[model samples]
Target: MTTPFSSLEDYIALPRVESLALSPDGRKAVLTVATLSTDRTSFDRALWEIEADGEGVPRRLTRSAKGESGAAFTGSGDVLFVSGRADASAAEAPDAPQLWLLPSRGGEARCLTRLAGGVSSIAATALDGETVVISADLLPSSRSIEEDAAARKRRTDASITAVFHESYPVRYWDHDLGPGVPHLLALETPGGDELPEVRDSVETGRSADESRGVYPSHLTSPRDLTPTPRRSADTAGQALTPDGRTLIASLRVAEKRSGRFVLVAIDVASGERTSLFDEPGVHVESPVISRDGRRLAFLRAPFHTADAPADQEIWVADIDGGDARRIATDWDRWPSSLVFDRDGTNIIATADHDGRGPIFRLPLDGSAPEQLTTDDFAYTHVAVDASSGDLVALRSSWTRPPHPVRVRADGEVFLLATPAGAPAPLGSITEVATTADDGARVRGWLLLPDGASAETPAPLLLWIHGGPLNSWNAWSWRWNPQLALAKGYAVLLPDPALSTGYGLDFIARGWNAWGAAPYTDLLAITDEAVRRDDIDEDRTAAMGGSFGGYMANWVAGHTDRFRAIVSHASLWALDQFIGTTDNSEFWQTVFTPRGLTENSPHHFVRDIVTPLLVVHGDRDYRVPVGESLRLWSELAEHHADDDGTTPHRFLLFPDENHWVLKPQHAVVWYETVFAFLDQHVHDRAWSRPAQLG
Candidate 1:
């Protein structure tokens, strides 16, 4: 019997499991699952617990309106999570995310700490878990929590909404950064009636001397662990030692020339900080400390510039900052989600291979890395039990959503949890391979609708992945191709040049030239896919977002093979885009005017012949809305001389950010896209989406 997977409505309603965390004793595991709310407007996440031995059924642990996430375990086996739920006794802010603790055996979770600014992240020691470190936002002028609250009240009473900027990067991907600076605080919790106390450590606040940098003091109870005048240091990835004495974190230091990240260790008692690893133009991130507190493993990559593309490698070093070396240097794929085994002799990590994200074990003794997983499914948030050596991860594929699974050391994989609801039956997924113009092998995934065959062919939809630096190796909720398959159309997902999981040499081919090998690789793979008897070569369309969107625009201008093209949040003019994008500083460092002029798609817009649909979000600062605006204006001007019957449209989202997040908005996006494709690719009558009306 075949599984059931239906339309977009059914697809969005499926439960999605994001992360997995195992307890210190390795007896239980907690998984974070997100499901659509009752109103279907957004998703609400909750923590679920399962037996690590795969003996007990999955059980829901915490339930709240605001939802709980970022689950971590203490040494006592109690689960700690962050949530925005209010506390009646402490009069906590309703929107601030506070730390909550759930007892090891079984009991109601209680609030652990209440600060002016909610906690963003938490890390604990593996030995006793008595010491915890949390990152929170603090206003510059406020020296205490009460002062911070008063400052906020005064601003609200005065109806004042202004943010003073003294540094770069005023805004991030989806939110504004200002008014408050991020600070790290250490807390001691004994797990009893005794309340947690903040210890005096590093000093907090900015100095009056402008030359020293803008380090304003804020609500630092004890003190700040990292306090460098004028220079702002951000804590990205942090891991506490087993004894809770030293904290190792990836610190991004802002400089005049460029921003670079280094791994540093901070003493919990004396607040002394020492740089463990620092490179001139390389960034170190995702630091994971061993249980014995002897080694550190992290991923390092070159600082991305127009001239340089990111190529990641795994690095291992002694905790004392000695014997540092890079491992898996010859590995083709980029490693992520680093975790060390119980013996500390091996490091477990995940990387995209071909079209799947597989788990690999790299030995510390310089042995060849061994592939632990052999399947078409992708895995993430991997955790290994120290006692049993068994693994638990969230696995997904093109035909399936994310779910919890248990993999034994002997290569035995078992599904731990299956969501309750049933989705409509999906089409078959197969591998497609071909050789590029450079004689390099390229691979992709093809989804063929049910009943498709040589006699009964299906229309093709070429979907390019964003992050020209990323790969299509995992299941995606936003850019899902299953919905298109449900409409009787086959979808092709290709990994062209610049796509990760391939070696660094493959990415260098398209480093500064967006219209070169990457484009040719895509075309080569597409040609091989359409040659299949089950695919209808004449009836095809192309679509992509971000970097993929840039490719979509380039494909439309360079070729007339496709009937229609959809470009979302794409870059049209290289010169204008480089200056307006949120990352202008980085772009200015690596890109030159000459190279941009030669590769920009806007220079060749007049050659376009395919019908185009442009989509963008006003809040997308990464690739500003102006790119879409310019592309639409040029397309309109080019088609103005032709018959006014040309079907070209623009879909704009005012409230959405880089990605379409709202449930209703996502539904509308798919409806509009499918309707446009049906009209141009299938010769069907035009139908306006009901949601638009």
Candidate 2:
């Protein structure tokens, strides 16, 4: 039997559980699972229900061709989700994702809102179930939902796609920021019968648009909660008080070439806004309201500078913005998420710790945080059962994909029944460590194939993680190492300087000096791994994407130890990347003129002797395609022969962004990567994939 890890088709077809949402009553939990679509070109997400106690068989809740996501429970136990599924009775299909409700009593899901720009995300659902807050895009010229819809309709009819931006960043990651500004809207319950009717004849199905409402049954008119918002409302982290009276949100305050997020409170009924915390050079995010509606807990992080990195400090304050204090002052790890406990006495947080993301319990009394889980797995989407005080989350490690799990207050974890069973093991994983020249500790996770020893050694693939600020502590669908292990390669995921989970001092070691400490750390760790008997040092390769991709380019020019190098969405020229990337402001501060001259990989193209593979997505905005274009041009100018033939190959994804996300594209990505490595590292004949043609 061919395992999922061995066959890319089977791997893409495997069901993936991405998120978990627990009911407040603690009776059931809902999971969002993505499966391969019928065409095999996309993944369709649907909702599944499983018992919170880990006893009942998993049951499918909602299915649609367009898919559903962002599942959250209303106060009345209704499942609120966002979907782009079209309505059969409607005259036209929905152009964007709309809010839908799957009743607690079990019935077909129904559309609730039909704004032209559609819903961005569900901010919060009031505990009383009478009001729900959501974020939606509104044209700056429009004041109400109807006006915004009309404005969008006119733009569509005229085929106008221009956006007038008064902001620093007009684009992010892969897409343009907006012709519309994001605003928080509240939907008050009376079943939508009393709302004013819309007057767009072309929009409503009825002949007399003046006398007809825009939507059919279950239509709820939205009241603007944050009006006159620029670009600040889109990325706000919001939480609603249990009584549905106040909304706590982190709104971005635009600055010169940069921005800072400040926590704010809004009166849901009166639409009044008040600032909670607005300190300079700091960001407040991840607001969580206590169950009793008396307090708020959020993460405060100072902006990073060229000289040093910053830490995320967990802070708590009263609902009225009084009695503020920082908790777990002694904790060194940076928390990625936080949620208040059932009784609001402690905060259940998750942070990266020594190559694993574990749940921690931080008490309100300013005491030390308690480590809850000791396993080598990472947890996400953690939710507390207010009725039972138990916690449920989605957990996974390098050896496994994400699956729903029930965690007790005492840190006991139980695997819940899921439709997606575990795939065959790819290989075994261990640890590798070494000391850098500066006497700093560097470590990484190593995946080794089975039956590898001194007699039959496996080729080592040194995999560098992106983020330069991120850690390889969790499972990644995009940068999975399991596939490499299944192909008889030992994969090494190293966390050099600037990786999180380690103390701030560790990250500072590479501050504005990417090529110095971070570079040496990779070499030191690779040396330690290659020294082992089970690894073949002579057949080693290096590969990375994003920052990792940048490092791969650096390694190719800096050393000849690796047989091959694969750089994906990498930064080739620091001077060019610093100005062209999505956020030029932050990069400008980090890259001094001297640093750019010393660290740029393009400056050392003549030193590269090993075969190289360069992969990039045209839509990538973080590290623009220009970097690779310049690198390719430089490679050809310096190394290409008379026939213009070179060992280096460039794989470009026209439709992909920073990552190749489409199902078909992802398969091709892996196929091309495997072929390149085989040709160079394994000394196999160069065989091009037919799909590339």
Q: Write the per-residue lDDT of candidate 2 for residues 367-459, one digit (tens) a residue.
A: 889999999999999998887888889999998889888888889999999988888667788998998888888999999998779999999
* TM-score (C-alpha) between model 2 and the true structure: 0.96
Question: C-alpha displacement of 112 in model 2, angstroms?
Answer: 0.9
Candidate 2 lDDT trough over 10 residues, lowest sum:
191-200
lDDT of each: 0.80, 0.87
TM-score of each: 0.92, 0.96
- lDDT score, candidate 2, position 130: 60
Cα deviation of 576, candidate 2, in Å: 1.2
State the TM-score for model 1: 0.92
Give each model's clash number. 16, 0
lDDT winner: 2
Native-referenced Cα lDDT, model 1: 0.80
Model 1: lowest-lDDT 10 consecutive positions: 210-219
